[model samples]
Target: MTLALHRHGPDGVPLVLLHGFPLDARMWDDVVAELPGLPVVTVDAPGFGASPRPDDVARAVGRSAEPALETYADAVAAALHEAGVDRAVVAGLSMGGYAVLALAERHRGLLAGVGLLDTKATADDDAARANRLTVAAAAESAGAAAVAPMLTQVLGATTQAERPEVVERMRSWLAAAPPVGIAWAQRAMAARPDRLFTLEDLAVPALVLRGAEDGSAPQEAASTMSAALTDAEVVVVPRAGHMSAVEAPGPVAAALRGLYERCAQGSVG
Candidate 1:
């Protein structure tokens, strides 16, 4: 479990961030900059960024191999432990959100707070699962280009039409994703189990964020997650899509900063 971890700030329980599929810790650069003095830690998912693929034993460093978010969560916990952090306000967006739940389910003691952004707590439906597997297979053969079509579904209409830079930026990230990582992440996500119950017992402050224009993770999903969380605040970023943090860093960062402060005060469960 040698997931790459990048820590920021000098002390305090850092806000640990997980990136969405096909992207790396760099996705949070804008949002992290907006965070000012807050402590932060960003880790690349297995097979993404500087981390090794689950099956890339030559670089796996340690632990078993599987296309499971539990594996990703374990790697995350291990990375943080190595960094001397026993607890943190962990947050994730899209695919990253899936791992966040896995962490909550498996390493509940490590969480100071939980943030779910542009993601759902349910397992992929039959069609969704099939599509993911198909894409994974295609990506393995065609490389990152196989996921390029997802660019349309990732950014909001407003962003695609107005923020050409952001769309192009997302395109580059998608294009730069490792083919093996892309395929592995798709399969892992497809095989995930329903995790709504995990949040029901989280007993930590939660933030459910969605993009007002997000087509992938709609308002319904956000509501379902908020409903499951005992202490949750739902925030919708306007003119943003599935990549809300990148599309609207100010709002996303503000929401995260609030969650961080709550966890820091140790005022909430």
Candidate 2:
């Protein structure tokens, strides 16, 4: 699938970032801007931005495999290999976090560190799974605008009440999202397995963060992940929500910068 990759800066171990559902690599622009010389690689997930849809990718060109985040991870690894990056600090938010975990499972050798922000290691409960399927059906039937109602749930109460502009921006993104991409991602996420075990053997440094006001990805979820990881710390971002990196880029950027510096150090890898 060789997802689209955008590189920034020329120093340090490359910090790879994955975006949440329906959003593309552009979501990381602000966070990347905050890190001056730290090399950064932002990837647009399958079917998002300029990348080809899953069924159109080289690996999936034939009778394609079922929708799975692991496929996306393989594409991510391929893209990195194409860019000549053998190792990197990988991070993600929401659905991106799910993909990050998939990559950790399938391509652990490529990870220097991991940042799990506003995400959980558990699989979706029956309710959540049904909701995802419902949303997928809606996206396929009505288009990306079907996810527009999710804006309130995705953003924090603080962001919704105090930063209407951010909410508006997200709304626009949602409206413009591709229906096929939305359906594929939603179904993939719904079928994902519980991945807390993925963190159990991860001896590498890890940063688990969640917005204090995040309803979607609770602090308990971050705690569970941090407890599973061998070497990890949890950071609670104030006044942010599921989209912490977007709601409050400063703290998210700082946390990511610290993680990159730690993993890029002479003694780590």
Candidate 3:
């Protein structure tokens, strides 16, 4: 599938950004400003945002041995190749974080570094997977509009309580997504293999950024990932929820800049 991509900056270290499920490349808009004048590539996931929906959601992500993360990673790799980026600092949020780790494992040669934002590397517990399946069913039946508000509430920090516009924007983004796409992503995520097995073998610099207020990727999960990655650093952005880039752009950007610059300068690679 030809994924829709948005490029920012004309020159700099290559960065491939993957968005979470139920949202698309546009979710990175707030973070993009901090990366002004730096080459970054952001793509909409298959069946999400501006990307085309797959005829069969399960098969689209990867019902095969490779799993969905591999397909999503390859898509980003292809996007980078098409953009003439031989190597990049790949970053992803939530579902995107899983994709980033998948890339690190399957295509390490194509990446200079990795940023896992508000995501976990562990496989979903049975209860979590079952819950996701339930969510997928609801999304398939009730539609994106119905689930969007609930998502906003779950993803936002307490500060977002008064931000009707933020919630509305999230709603509009989710509502615009095809129900099949959301459901398919949910299933794919639930079925994703445990990536913890691959972390101990990592050879690249890594950043594990979690929202201080993020319930999905709590501090404990971040600590576990940091412990697994020998060369990884952890950054906890205060006052943010799942959307750290949107909630605390400055700190997130600082972390990105530090990692990318260190890699570029050949200090950590």
Candidate 4:
């Protein structure tokens, strides 16, 4: 869907970074700044950041009945095509992780490696799905301000206590997000399928990372994903939460750099 992108670095295996739900590509600024001399791309998924809305995405995907995650993945593929990237190390955070799995399922050949950060491989339970719909309806009715509290829910206690500025930055980002976009994301995430099998069948190097204090993606979730992968490494970043890339950019970037090197060398196993 001609998604907006932030691109940098030279010719090589591109690293595509997907931000979490309700957040734009700017979330990767800290992490991107740490990695030098590597081709990188950060995308604004449909209905988020500067990208088009759900209607525009549906038109770009040429299917109205398809799942939103798959459509978002298609948009990523289109973005990669525009950038002349045939293969890449795709890394996603939270909702972005969900999109990464969908991309693997739909566009496996394009992935050189996969990075799943602070996300789960399971689908939403009945209650969680219902809650997401409820939140979506609220966003549609009341706008982004209504969902501002979600920032507190997702950020770790350490961040809230020691990194007030980061919390404020996140609040600003959430508050400025388009309400329609937020609602669309909620519905899309609610409808995402369980993707554990995708992890089990992963043919590329896989890295599963979670913030030690991340409530959204707990340790157990990371273990489950690790167990399913044939070649996977599980890492827990201390003093971080759902937004590990933001809270612990150094460690997160280090892990990503290692993954990229491993993928580039074809030495994942």
Candidate 5:
């Protein structure tokens, strides 16, 4: 798939980051800046941002017509391989969080640990699946402008005046996303396997984080996963929402730095 990537940091244990749905790697700009001396890679998922959307959904999904998250995970692992990163810490936001868990499942040896930010390891409920389809239909019908308001509301409530910039960023990202890509993501998420078992199934270090204000992921999910994981940590970034990388980059970066260092040092018990 060859997703477009933005690289930062130095030649240390590589850290791969996947941005949330409807957003590209730009969402991690601030967080990436916080990792000063480690090799960092941020990728745009296929069909979003600068990456090309797959023309063959059936092929990607394997007869179900649903897009596969593994396909995107494969693309990410391929990108890391192309850059000579055999193993590293993997982190993701929202849909990217799904990618991280899939990566862990498919290539546990290739990951030092995982950071799941504002993302759940569970599969989508029926209501969530229905909502995604509904939104996808609307995105196809109304284009980027129609979804901008909801994007703003879902991200977080800044001051009334601060709303404009948030909406503008979302508008730009959505406008740039191909409609096919949006639809494909919706189907992919709907069909994704529940990865809560990934925590117990593998001993890889993990950190689950969410915004204090994030209604999407909620604190209960993080607590549940953290309690279940053999070596998992939970963090709540105050005053942040779904987009903590943007809303509170400092804590997110700090969390990444600590997670990476622990993984690098073999500190996870």
Candidate 6:
């Protein structure tokens, strides 16, 4: 199934924003607002936001032993083609980052640059994989609401303590997420391949960003990824967490603007 695409701006190297698991295109609302006239495309990966669910997605891509991340990358590539964008600077947060890496691996020619935000290149460890599977089972059996407790772990301490509105907004998104989508994402993430080699071989300009307080993708992970990329800039947003784009839109937008300009100037691969 064709994923839903939210288009913005025009006439430049396209900036494709991919949101993290259980969230949708709306997660980029504030950052997009800050970007103003820069060309941007935010996508709802399969089973999230306005896009088709996992069953439809599985059918659309046909049966395969490939991980779902590759399927997601293909959907994004198709969406861009339909939008008349031949190449784009792809940026993603968390699960979105995994998809971006997958895109780089399978559809390298379509990328102009990459933004890895609050994510890592390492595959899940055994314990982490088991935990993800457990979460998937819980989400399947009890619905999306069963994953609400993740808010505490995903957000920064400051966001949890002071940003009631942000917390509520995130909660709403998580609560409304499809159970099937959550389960599918968890399983896919658990099974994701380690892509550190992809980063090491990257030819395009890349940005590695993370919230200073991000537990999911720590500062060390950002540094490691930055070290791997041939050309990369690292940005750590203070007072933020896993959802740095939401927690610190100003810094995230500024960083994105820099990446966009680099891509537009033909400096990026």
CA lDDT scores, all candidates in order: 0.89, 0.88, 0.76, 0.88, 0.78, 0.87
Q: Model 3, range 1-269, lDDT digits (tens) per residue?
A: 44677888877657778887778888888788897767778888777766665433235444453226566676667656766677888889999998888887888888788888999988999999998888888887888754565555445565377556666776677678678777777877888888886778777788899888898888888888888886788898887788777667778888887778767766332
* C-alpha lDDT (0 to 100) for residue 187 of candidate 2: 88
Off by over 4 Å in 4: 65-67, 267-269
Greater-TM-score candidate between 1 and 5 = 1
Which has the greatest lDDT? 1
Off by over 4 Å in 2: 58-63, 266-269
Cα deviation in Å at residue 113, candidate 4? Answer: 0.1
Q: What is the number of residue pairs that collide in model 3?
A: 0
What is the C-alpha local distance difference test score of candidate 6? Answer: 0.87
Candidate 1, residue 172: CA error in Å?
Answer: 0.9
Give the least accurate 10-residue stretch of model 2, judged by summed lDDT: 56-65
Backbone clashes under 3 angstroms, per model:
0, 0, 0, 0, 0, 0
Residue-pair clash count for candidate 5: 0
After superposition, candidate 1 runs with Cα above 4 Å error? 56-64, 267-269
lDDT string for model 5 (77-162, tens) is: 77677777778788999899999888878777777888889988888889998888887787678765445655655566651246
Model 6 residue 164 distance off true place after TM-score fit, in angstroms = 1.4
Model 1: lDDT equals 0.89
lDDT of 2 by residue, 140-231 (tens): 88998779888998899999999988999899988899887898899899999999999999988899999999999987898899999988
TM-score of each: 0.96, 0.96, 0.89, 0.96, 0.89, 0.95
Off by over 4 Å in 5: 56-65, 158-167, 267-269
Q: What local lDDT does model 4 show for residue 198?
A: 86
